[model samples]
Target: MAPAIRVEIEKKHIDEAIERARTGVSKEESYYYGDRLTSGLQLRVQGRQAFWALKYYNFTKTIGYAYPAEDKHLPSVSAARKLAAACKDILDDDPKMLEPMLVKYYGGADRDVKKAKKEMVAVSTGWTVEETAEAMIAARTKPDTDDPIKKSTVAQFRLTLRRPQVKALSKKPIADVTKADLDAVKREMEKSPEGASMIKKFVSDIRSILTWGATHATDMTSLDPSNIWWELVKSGKKKRAITRSPIVDDIVKTLILAESYLERPLPGRFSEGKFGVGHNVLNALWWLALSAQRTTAGTRLRLVDFFPDPKRLGSGWYLAFWAEGETKNGKAFVLPVPPRAAGFLQERMAKAKRNGDSQWCFPSSQARGKIEIDIPVDRNSPGGVTERMAVRDYPTKDKIAKELAKNAKWESPYVDLLAENDIMYWSPHDVRRTIVEVLEEHGIPGGASAVLAHEVRLTDDLLFVDNARNREQYLELRVSRVTKLAYGAGGFIPLKSKAMEVWTNTLIDRYEELHSTYRQARKKAQAERVLKAIYSDANSAAEAKEAAYLELPKIRRKLEDNLTGHKQMLSGLLKKTPPPDAGVRTARIEIELAQADLDAFNTDPASYAIEPSRRAASRTHSAVLQSALKTDEKPVDLVVEAPAYTQLRDQFIADKIDVHTFRLLITERYPITLDMMDDRIITGMVTGDEAL
Candidate 1:
């Protein structure tokens, strides 16, 4: 091989030459030209061959590279020189370029070094990338300490938001809420005035929640401050407007109207036992209003709550106990029961006991096992019983009070019953107020606060002394007085004794007639049942007899036919001859006998032992028709007539029966009047008729 060309060039000189070439200067004027000339002369091994070839290659590739002018010798020479120059540049930049050649010399071998290193690291540390990420997040966001917001306050806030009306309104985004929306909700509440207070509370609660969220929510930055609940509250306050209370008279009248509508039937008064717009609920509401307690509490009163002692000192009645949980203050408050209250409780209790509800005096029809009565007995008392009694159970006090607030006669019931009834905002609390007013009127100083369960201190003042003694003395005197006024001497015969007697006699007579009619009906039903049983037994026996008779004939005919076939078969076989188609003939005779039997059965099925079914069917149809007709008759007519007679008899006995009593009795039971009864006598006879 020709001696390889060698050129010594400094690193700086090569960099200078490359820069000059990049700048478009002629290579001959650069540092590389002088170095190339000196090296070419000293190393004469390749002489002008390397110099001319490299120079020509560099010249052609300066602007753009090209193959040598197609001449065979020059082209090969130029290609070799170019290859050598590229190798030199690579060797100069990286000494490791010689590693592959060294590996080739050493007989190239495979190794697991890289993979082993990775596995070693992985085994040493078990944590994955995801576990690390999760740990980091936990460290950043977790609460730092235990003393956070109180759970009870949070629960209250949640409950406040959970009201039905609040929940419905809160479904929208908090930001979009407006006063118009609140007004709309208020308007909806107007439809149920009884629920207005609850609605107001609910609105206030929602505003609080919004304000809390705006101030403390972690994501509050995304919320607009203007849309916050606090903003709504402030805006509302700025645009304050007065709202008028509904006319109490109109509301009371509406309640009365509802009662008039409910005079049809008990179920008619309320659909699904829910106090719809009706009299029963309204009446309960009136009681609540008069009692000066929540409507729900009054309406849900239980017989057990009233400890009526006919011999008690005050009002001949005593509401000695009430449940702690049921009171507004959530503490058991003793009531100085009045005679009127005691009478009402006793009457209700008797009625409930008669109806098989002695355990629950005011049990709801829908809720079973929710018996309300559970009176705490004073174990230390002289004659107290330790065991709590469940004389009657009623709904929770809150529920009863709520229902009463919406009652129909809330306004007029007291006005009509008592004179000088100038009062506003009449409610169950007003009943307590009335008691207080009456006590004060009678010069009983502390009577107002004590009987009303109001917080008051008993000092040495005259008023205080009066308050201390008046409740007890006044209650005793009033009980006797009212008792005499209502039921006369002995407190047994009602003041309306004559009227009650007449009503009772009439009722007894009518009831006797009804009992007679019912007995007759029952006897008729028993006779029909007995007749049906006898007929059924007879029909069964007749069917069995017919079946036995028909079965015997069928068996006899089959036996006779079989015997004749056997005789023919035996004759042919005894003759030891192929008796001319004897087997076939026997078969034909058997088939013909069977056909005849079938034809007889088909022509008259009764002959085949089927029992006649018409008699039983006819009897059943007749019984059903008779029972239906009896049911269709007017059953209510007798019941209706009986109540009037009872009222008339009661009126006669009490000597206080009047048109109002008659009207009430008729409205409650008969709901109709006879033309013969005089309006004036009936009107005069009733005690509360004029008052109502």
Candidate 2:
């Protein structure tokens, strides 16, 4: 018996090994004929026979047993070498080539050859961009379920990524898809610049699909379309507009008008009368704004997710809603619901209690028919989300915005009624921007990111254990006071004092003022038309007086109705002894002015018919100060003591109040701007004009 040895295969070595095998000198061991171009090809010798075999990576089994010296069918050493070299070339140049050769030489009985042949076919034909993408999609398995991918994601991919324009690229072999192919797809999509985002997402989805297929299917080539987006970006061909936040006044007016529209069914749609769907939309918008959670989180919000008991964590009735892993980031977290957002949820809960459907916090009408499944059968079971019910559950953020746009008449009355306004419509996500902007205006640093739950680059101080302890202490000691200011609990303003009321009143005032112009114009026009009819007929004076009597009250009543309705709303909001600085004073004054104009018009409709003269003096302010020392124009005489200023400085540092608010408070007795107060005033620094 001889010890098995691994040696480089040469003609000399093969001949010596064959001679030893025939004489039974090394019959117990096999001789490996190693090929530099290929792996696992060997000449096994046992007794007086030798077999050509392979134990390569793909073909992990030995095949073809023949005695080269005795059998007429077996090839000579030179022929065997040539055959091995051909197999090596087949493996390199064409994997499919090995399939037919394996079937011919090794036969179908060879397991490794059968497996390798199957894989070779998949790699050759099934690795086209389209086929590989499909394969990757099919192979995906989600946790705790048999769903390959989310239905919504599948629909999105089909709509955006699998467009007809990409069909040609999809047909190309995955490896053969060049930058040119991707650029062509980009150009095709770029024709509709609105879909610039879709093209970017298409590139990402394709890259992800191909990468997954390459690793998992063992049949696809590496495909990365990331460069396509970069190329488009570098070329400055990509066109995506930045969406601005909706003005806060527009948001409030939209909600109010939407509520009005809800009172009556939509002009053409909304068959179910007063289903509170308008309130649902308004509530959803408010929730998105105040909570700063994405629409998906708001839609899937459940009644069970709320922790109403104020006893826990001293949160004082905060909604500790839990978002699932299905969020934008695959992370589950508990979001602290602000008071305004919680108010919306509480309203929904109250409605649910009245009507026994309390499963979803913000359920759609379709949810009424949905019954919860105690036991799950599949992804489409009763417990699973349904497409029909997804408008409010797993809803698109733009759903509310689109609905508002579709019902534009709901907001049209408030759209351009004020100061040459153009605030027509806005998306629900704009609410997030609105909140962030308002907080920014109030000088709350990093509050926007904190509210939105966006990831921020943490500094060493933020990560320090001592800083963590300080945060814990603040939360524990000042949670109630801070929550009032930040969350607007118990009539506390989340913004500047009476900001929401001022905006609401301004919207109402503008609408009423516009109505007043239309009313006076219509009345005058109607009177002229009536007088013309009388004059053409050559009627008596009694006829003209009769027409006036018939028309004037109706016009007056319409204008008065608007003013009366607004007055009622304002009167409710107005405190009996409102603080002089309170915004309610302005709303009260507006109502009084509107009421006075209405009464004066009723007394003399003919005189009121004339349009008022425009005052050029009021249009622009004069650069020179008035020579008269008017009491209203006089600077405030009150002086802030050093101790009070020092206290204000400490309060600003403690975050008890913002710098702007502190300035407003100190200058409340005076007609002073926030700009006039300056940081120096807050820090008690002596100005050249002031004594410290």
Candidate 3:
């Protein structure tokens, strides 16, 4: 068939083989050349062609034709030898390089040439951080991919680098990006705990961009942020570079005011009408505080996720909530909400029943009134109005963020109400933090974390029982304690459950005192301003009468003191005859003068009525002034009066009146005059001591 000649291919042999191969071949024959230790190149001959080939270790390739054909496209003997030498050089440089080097030398026939050329171009060109980031974003967000990136992830990446300080570095060449640039980003956000958390994310996003670019676009210089793990010195102490929860009491106070604002919304500036959104926000705040759920988990709650306790007879004493695909850890969790939160949930259910039963508990107004797409329709109708297609929409982190921002907007209708009540602003996460702290302070360390975990276990298997009912009961007991302590609502269990009772009472007391003090301060400020206005306006005669109306109490006290002193002197008048008569006459004359002055003051304003009445036009001012003052007092009473007992009875029946609500009512009734609402009074009104 063919010659089985094995020899080291030399220059002369290649020349002779090429000349013979141009004629034709009977079968395939090969002559190998180069070092045996490193493997060899082959000059193979078959039917009408001879080509150069290689087999070195794992690498095998057919480089090119060895001899010229009709088209004379094949390499000459010397050229083939040069190619073999080039392949040998590439392999000598790197054993892995045979495919790519062969592709480079041979051109169009090889698929790897395109890859090689692209790699060369990438290595040669310098890519800026901005350019590489855009490329990375595009690649991640490509359409019709098996695993598309999350929209939130894309937005986060865009936002992280868009900050003014970090944005400047985007124009820097990737190769020139040093750890210093990363450190600069950290420095900008390191001082603020919230900002520190963002910095960590920003660094993570940047590193991801650099890593992606290293493989896809350019060889990025190593920028591992881990290498720059320097401690953030704050107040000379090494600060823990992470976001921390806010103080528990601050959150509690703010939530109390938030609750009040929800009830009586302030006048609107930006939005008009009722404050349904405020109700949603208030519920979200309580839910997060009681459940210690992440914002996403809580906001994404659906009506279907709730499982009411059979034992509670659907009073929502123990409710289990589980939202799929909406957890920080990415696992579905069955969270047991405490009694207070359950009460809130029960109210929400009633509200939803009245409001068309929206699918989500905190549903977006945008998606609340949608129609299902699967509804049967007349296909042949010439013209018909069809309902908008319904889609399952869950509240996302972005949506919740926008809602919170809207609530806190300066132009928000309710902002003035919060401000007037001395309520401060706080993020939703702060509630979770506050819950954690309250739990820890009252002997449930890591209790809040268990609230967020899929399994409800913390330092014991109380919640890990094999029986579902026992597990639920344990979860309820655990969650109930924390909620009762933080919210000061739900039927109080017992003080014997650790220090929950004392801790809860202390927190509630602190919140009440703070709220009362702020109210008193506001009242004092208002009083001072009113008095100042009265004194300033006393320049006119008619205004002086109004001023006298305000000064009525001081004037009456002075007149009573003078009459009492005059009567005391009558005891000594009986001792002497002339003295008694003289004393009696003197007393009569003094009384007459006082009566005369009082009569003049009560009549029309005279020019010489009294020293203080110099500005009074006439005595008739007193009559009008007294009526105006009484009218003002009536409005004050109307403003400060508690809701009627009928309303209180309705609220109590609805399970809407909490300890805070009761305290607020009492405060409204007496304001700064009362020390505190008596617990006995509250007990009589609310029934069991557990409620207090």
Candidate 4:
């Protein structure tokens, strides 16, 4: 036997012990230093190495190493003191709890201790790990807070605990579960073909249960929730891959539109057993896609929770509520959806009220005909709505997974579902992600966070805070919490509404209105230019113009044929087209666009057309008059530049024109009639930009 002594368990004492351990010691010998600071912890300083162990119930077990800070494998002096304290408490109150723990760490004891263990096991048996987990699950069913554990979570938790490797460990006494056993469970999870994300969730769920059981379960009283040795078991460092594929927005719109057109035949090839899923199922899925809400709270939405005229806000828009604890963020959210989504929801709610359906807007209806009233959707809960929707519209491999209770529950492939829409293997969760990404891409940033009802930890907020001091806008984005402190929840409505509008607009396969608007703008500008060309054209002075000159004004006398005639035609069309239509709007835009062209035409003296027969004679007479009137002036170049440019500098000095008009005359190289000058200045002023 080696010598044993008591000493303060500090770094200095440990360093001294390490020195003694390395020097003046035989390789075969070992020394034991009992911790003076803690009751059960001791330092085993051997010739080759040192260890931290706990002595309790006639057996001592090596828990960790003692030197070189144990290469992060073992706790340091401060952490070891805390662990030693916990061990002291466990040993003083329930030493047997540490018995299996020691056996697991140090392996089987000598024959005498093993025989004693048999007797000890017979008397002090506790609940198995499986029992502790079940108890934890049962406690979860009765929620302690408003934020209750989801049924799907509990179900998934059950599935993870029941795995073969986990099962074998779970069957053992809770106290016997060693670091190695937990590590083995992690390896088994890693072997699963379900991929890293699923494996990650499995480890996380099991870890939560283990932690909850340590504090909550009766048989797991002695275990520390925070200090469980399973903390060493990691889910690996691999980042989870994005499993669901991105869908084209136009394809998504087509899918939504197809729902109204495609008749999902009942008792079809995809519909396996019972009649088939009804419209309610599809509606729930659509709501998820439109709202970007989780399946649980979204599918369970009651009609009353939807406020069509919140605070008497408006008719076309709406405000929706999900109570606190219902959402993943655990905050009550008042959401606003697009007009189309709101319209559909209102129509459904109105129909439900007429049908005397209790609360759920979408009731159970598996029949091919009209749905039955007074119950929720075909499923009582939101648990398998995604899977059922996938099966009916899109097929999934989930039915083959052993975790699900049913073996392919009521299989059906309603032909007009997601597959017919070309996104066959769809995830409703990814649908939420898809829309959020679209909104972020299209400049409505808040819609991304607001869709999932997420907290505002976005990079937008960071930029806002960072740029606030610089007094510069870092982003031209959506109205988020940073911009809406005074408006509160109501402010998000319009922002989210705009986001949905942008999303829906993007979803349109052919944006005819947008194209029409662009084309109209181009034609308006082009029409004005064409009119100017016609006004100045030599061929426009008709033989008929000289006859009409008897009763005409001088400007009208010069406007012999083309633009003057086209203006008459434009006026005629404006009279024939009905008011408030695209035709009237188009006529008005063209007329407005031609204002400057007409004014500039009338202002320039040379733009006037002359009678065709005498045009050469009239120009020769004008040239003779100008030559006779010249006095000591040099001959000028044939300048086509507008006369306004030569006089605007003097006009500006005299305060006869403001900055914009000055720029317009100098830069645009043109002038307008007095009547249109104000409008021209206002429109032209927008161009006065300078580099800082």
Candidate that would win on lDDT = 4
Per residue, candidate 1 scores C-alpha lDDT tens digits across 460-574 of: 1111112344657744553344333223332223222222223223322333334545446555444333333222322233334343444656655765666566667656655
Candidate 3 clash pair list: 541-615, 603-619, 604-619, 605-618, 605-619
Which ranges of candidate 3 are over 4 A from the true structure? Answer: 1-244, 260-268, 271-277, 311-316, 348-354, 368-425, 456-692
Cα-based lDDT at residue 161, candidate 4: 72
Ranking by TM-score: 4, 3, 2, 1
Predicted structure with the largest TM-score when compared to the true one: 4
Ranked by lDDT, top first: 4, 3, 2, 1
On a 0 to 1 TM-score scale, where does candidate 1 land against the true structure? 0.23
List, residue by residue over 1-692, the lDDT tens digit for candidate 3. Answer: 34335665566766666776777766444333442322456666665666666666677777676566433134544455555566666667765555545544445454343344444312213677887888788887876433347677889888877877687788777766667777776787666657755776776778778777765654444334444332231222344643456565555665565555444423332242354224555555555554556666676665545555444455544544443345665444555454445664567545532234455565443343543321111211100100000001122234435665676432212223333434433455555556656777777664445554554212322222234557567556645433333223322222212223333344444654567664565455444333222222221333443444455556655655665666666556756666767677897677666656555544533222233443342343345334334445422221122224224323432335643574355335322212223321111121111110
Clashing pairs in 4: 270-412, 270-413, 271-412, 271-413, 272-411, 390-394
The alpha-carbon root-mean-square deviation between model 4 and the true structure, to one decimal in Å, is 26.7
How much RMSD separates candidate 1 from the native structure?
32.5
Supply candidate 3's per-residue lDDT for 103. Answer: 40
lDDT score for candidate 4 against the true structure: 0.52
RMSD of each: 32.5, 30.3, 29.2, 26.7
TM-score of each: 0.23, 0.28, 0.29, 0.32
Residue 535: error of model 3 in Å? 48
> Which parts of model 4 have CA positions greater than 4 angstroms off?
1-245, 248-276, 348-355, 366-375, 378-421, 454-491, 504-692
Clashing pairs in 2: none
